[model samples]
Target: MKKLLAFIFLISSFAQAQYTINGTMAPILESDWVILYKIEGASQKYVQDSKIKINTIDVQGKKQKIGTFSFTLPKDTEAGSYRVTYKLENAGYVDFIFNKENLNFGFHPDYPEQTVTFSISKENILYRKYLEKISNAQQQLDSIQITALQNPSLDLKSAYQTSLNKVNSIQNEYLTNSKDMYVAPFIKANSRNNPSEILDNPQTYMSNIIDTFFYDVDFTNKTLLNSSFLIDKITDYIFYINYSDDPNTQQILFKNSVDKVIYKFKNIPYKKSIIEFLIDQFETTMNLELIDYLFENHYYKLPKTIQDQKYITSKRALFATGIGRVAPDFSWIENGKNFKLSTLNDSEKYVLVFWSTTCSHCLNEVPKLHSFLKENKAVEVIAFALEDDEFGWKNYKTNLPNWHHVLGLKKWQNKIARTYNINATPTYFILDKDKKIIAKPESLEDVKTFINKQ
Candidate 1:
């Protein structure tokens, strides 16, 4: 039993392997704090232990931060790409492989992209030089293109084309040389052939790129998953490359791409992050409909941890708040008369507003709504103030005496607010005469536009 216990201890120690990162930076200020971020799935999480100070070290009369910045990776850490960054401007971030090996490096704050010197691995050094070459080529091409545009001469146009070809050639050569390195995939993903057949037919080109972008990429590779390179590439491919005016088609493409990636990920953290990323993208673009598809499949299948459950609930509520649904009925007392939302002036179109007195946006918008309602007799305002006390609502309500003003004294947790899934202040729902939600407007402008159309 004792021997077995000792063996287990040895295995635990092996899993807790430590890696040391020794590096230096010149032209760095002591006030600047260096941060290290570990890429997890689609996100970059800051490593608290990996932060190092930019202390000064003097070499002859000149000074450098070399040897002053060093951090040891925590034991049993996942092998992936780690990034080093500084708070100072133009001191661009650097990423390195953390495959259970110690790293030795030096860089200058002035020319981080061009001047990174790796002492331990020839792989990283070559990658840095390749990056510098690509960067310089791009810069030259940009200059040539600008000159061509300004002059519009045949000679200048020819020069621009030549420079662009040279950049592409250099990129292809670098990728060929660095075939097996971790950075190879990144370089390949980023380098695009100049003015190709894709430019002539953008839609077909974008669709082809979207289909084949991940062909060479190993989506299940933990190292690749942890690197921002893959996620960044995926983002650009989905958003920039696959630019479509038809939102229905765009949503389908986005969902298909996300589904493919998520299907490849068995790792819980990676899967969860990818799912969350898609959800955020949908929410940001106001494509709330796609969120229902996500929740119906990938979201519910994830481990029902507290965070996951919270996210699922939030998204579910958002999906439910879409148009054509019957507005949740609630009773409110105003002027000692009991009023149910569905029964309140069923003859006229109603605007249900979930607002707060303390919210500055509501303060500005509510008065505007009041004035607009007074002019337009076709619609009435049902303003539900999500406030803890009645004093603010009472004061604000006095001016807008014609509207059906109700005090949701429980604030955000008020039954009506929760039923409607009101997360933000000044939320508005345009209800038909029967109290069915017809439109969810973003602002007073949207409300005005909808009413004007009617």
Candidate 2:
């Protein structure tokens, strides 16, 4: 009876063991709290958030406020990858592995990835070492391979062989040590396929790399699917593998890479997630052509549940006003006659300027712009003055008589201004003879530069 009781007690104790994650941020700046999240696939599951406790510490004869926050994980917490986000700007967050172990780390908020250091986490410490050592070895191998390819006469076979051996050894060692831990799948998935022998031809070497890029990765692994590995891997494959000097050729390469990447995944949700990520990436860079291609080729084909029609409509609206698309049409009353923008066929190009009479910057730049365009005949300027009332605009338009002027009441709430998605005063859009938007200049200088180039 006594022995049975002792065994049961030991089992219970092990089951109830709790884990903790403690974080410290130096020079916390304006951030007052931190949120902890469990990263799963393309999303983050919010676990908890904590208010930071500031402590003033003297460093190098100067006082600094160091911020500290912590999260106590329940005994049954799922083990995998976790993220702590302090701020949203410039990716102010740190990712670490958690496997029923306590983690204590510190980092500078501005440079979290570069400066994060762990003090008391076995899983994280080993993972950090593995990344550093493996990355160094791989870089050395790449350098030697590139050098040998560049100078075929140079004898770099020995150096290349050594670097390859080092990479293999480091990878194998980490795989072995982390087999029972949460980081094993990450290490295995991150392994690169290296050539056994050096090749003299750059084209052949690159071809071999591209062929074997996804050989070591297991797309079906649940752990990999639940973490950021798959997305990161897909991103690397799509954007980093193919390069071309010609813009058109580069775009074709990108499409090919996307096809290759999408073909690797069998899960529908995963595929949808990757497509969404790609759309966001291209949208940020203002690559409307690629965005259109993705929507027509991939995004629109997905099932309705994952289609997100609202998001699709918003994206379409965004593209409607983009640089290759036709500008939205508007009309105004001039001398008891209604005139439409699309009906104007007077000039080879048109400049649409959205400005407010009350805006100081607009008041300053519009006059300068009028003077600059006085000598140019091929381009016609149409100025839309967004205002709450026409009193200020009527007084201001007398000086600039060369350009066609339209008074837009309600200022920011004006329909014409909203149609163009105007958020700031003095916004400029240059349209071609076909009424397609050719360029959206940032400032008066940009407008001058565009006209001068044409």
Candidate 3:
């Protein structure tokens, strides 16, 4: 009976075991809370969240406030990469390996990833050391190779060989040591492909580097996908490797590199995730042409289940308002007669100005615009006023009788405002005779400059 009871106790203890992640931020973080997430393929699953506690501490004989937070993992938590996001602005977060082990670390909020110091967790510590050593070795090799290419007469074969040997030695040691570990795949995927022989020609060396960039990467590795490694690798290849002085040439190079990247992945889900990431990157730069290319070529080809229909519609709406595309049609009642923006043939050029009575800037600029366009008979001004009520607009429009006036109720929630994606008042869109957008002016002065130039 005693032996049986002891075995039962052991099993109970094992089943009840839980891990914890404790974080410390010096010069106290601005955020009041921190959230923990388990990183899966292309998304993060919420694990837990904690309210941060601030405490004063001594740092080199000076008092400093530090923020601390902790997250206790559930007993059945899976082993993989985890993220702690303390704040949303400026990407205030840190990612680390969690393999059913307690982790303790500290970092500065401003530079979380760069300033992080691990006090515990063998996996994180080992991974950090491996990255530092390998990065140093690779930098040395690159420096030597660049020097050799720059000065062809000077022999750098011995230096290049020494640096290359160091990189290989570090890579092999980490690969062997991290065997069967969660971080093993990351180290393997991050291995640099060094040239076997030094090439005097820069073009040849660059070509070789680009060709072997993805030699060690396994696109289907779940662990790598869950982390930021694959996204980072793809970003470097598409943006950094492919460059040109001319903007048109750069766009073509980017497209070619994107093709090479997409061809490497056979898994549909992984491919979709990568393409989505690329779309987001281009969206930030407002590269509408590339965005259209991605949707037409890659995103549209994906399965319907993965396709985001709402996002597709929104993007199409944006394209509809783009320069050279006909503006969305809208109708309004003026003098008890319906008038449509598309059917207006009375003027050679139309100025669509979205303004609000409550906006101080709009109040200041609209009068100036009305005065300036009074003498210009060829240009017709469509003053669309976004308002909550007709009281102020009815009284305000008396002074600008020559301009066609349209009232948009519901202010920002107005259909026309939403259609144009208007966030601020006094926004101007200059349209040609065909009602196609020509110039999106910033101010009344810009409107004058554009009209005067024409």
Candidate 4:
């Protein structure tokens, strides 16, 4: 009898342990649905929606449908931030923190003036108030700043300074009081220019700012993984620190940013997230060599849990066709004419363009590029369309008749695109007469700049 009772108690405790979220969407139609999104793999995507049901709930001591909308987190769900969005006309979404607690939110879909309201969750309730206070304070500060800038009087300047001081005070007070809350570190990370610090040394203000930016941030805090606030804070910290105009200086600054972030993130998952983000950003640039550097220095040093063999292989592939490396040549067959890349273009330089007719960006960039290259006889365009069919290319070929147009049989998995690692449409690579990659311009403007430099 004792054993059976203990077993029953354990089962009940496990069953009762779960997070519950209650929401009210006013002016909601019968067919309208609400979506729940949780952060997955360093980003958020649609998970599932609440089903429409006619139900009753206690609303101000009365039963109603408006109060009946509720959803429960999965039993296996981890504690984190979740976003609730109602797909009603002109209605946005609301975010709240959940950690095995019952939380409630009230919002209106059509009315912008009706701000989101929360109950039962102390952290979310404080976050909403903090947002409102910041919004109101910013509007007042803007008015004062405009007046002071337009009319530079001693009194106006003093008032502007006073307003800034008050804003900093409010932020500091919140930081002290809400230290345990999820939003506290975010507020501290964003707070800037206290009166004492500003008055002491203006020259070293930026250095001070960088040192204290992530002072309170707990890299291992799983709660932060549920929201984009942490990611945005990381991005701002890296990009805004030690900005420079000189390309060499800028490159060093960027490299340092990655190294600093890797050193700070003690948690394996968080470290992996940041490393992947940095790798992705570098992959878009001609500076893909940075990815190789990171892989060798930081990524390889990480524990095996984060640095799997497949991930290492993928990173190596990105570095294969980096800047200063010879552009890989491929076969092009069009109208029974087989030609290698080197044989097609006899100009001093060649512009290899990988585009698809179906892509909207290609539609705009291709024509602009064709018009831009009309007078430049020194550079020839070897355009390859990665298309499933030649119909779209044939129709669009009239506008671009000057270049050597080749239709790739496979759309994304084309043999040439695979060789060159062309993941995005309208990718441009500027090569010399020897087929050596000189520049891989990001956009049409970049292409023009590279051409002028040449």
Tens digits of lDDT, candidate 3, 1-454: 9999999999888756978899999988678999998887666889889999999998899999999999888777898998899998777889999998999999999998789989999999999999999998899899989988889998889888988999999999999999999999999999988888788898999888889999999987889878878877889998898878999998998888988888788778778878878888987876777777788888899889988788777877666677766889999999999999999999999999999889999989999999988899899999999999999999999988788899999999998888898889899999999999998898888999999999
**lDDT (tens digit, per residue) of candidate 4 on 172-259:** 6777878876667556555544334222233454566666767766666666655766776777876766578998888888888777
Model 2, runs deviating above 4 Å: 1-17, 26-30, 56-65, 108-110, 330-340, 355-376, 385-416, 443-449, 452-454
lDDT of 4: 0.73
For model 1, what is the alpha-carbon lDDT of residue 181? 68
lDDT string, candidate 2, 4-55, tens digits: 9999998888756777789999987688788998988787899999999999
Candidate numbers, best TM-score first, in rank order: 3, 2, 1, 4
Q: Kindly list the per-residue Cα lDDT of model 1 for residues 1-454, writing each as its tens digit.
A: 9999999999888656776777677766443457778877677788843445556666798665542477777767766778888655654677787666677887776676567789876557676777778888978875665454455443665566678788988888988987876667666756644443112233544455566766666666655677887777767766776666897888787777667767877778777887788888877866666777777778778877724777667766766667876787889777788889878764468888889889999889988988877878889888889999988778878888778888887888887788788889899999998888899999999998998899
TM-score of each: 0.63, 0.83, 0.87, 0.59
**Higher-lDDT candidate of 1 and 4:** 1
Evaluate model 3: give its TM-score.
0.87
Worst 10 residues of 2 by lDDT: 311-320
Who wins the lDDT comparison? Answer: 3
Q: How many backbone clashes does candidate 2 have?
A: 1
Candidate 4's displacement at residue 63, Å, is 24
On the 0 to 100 scale, the lDDT of residue 12 in model 4 is 90
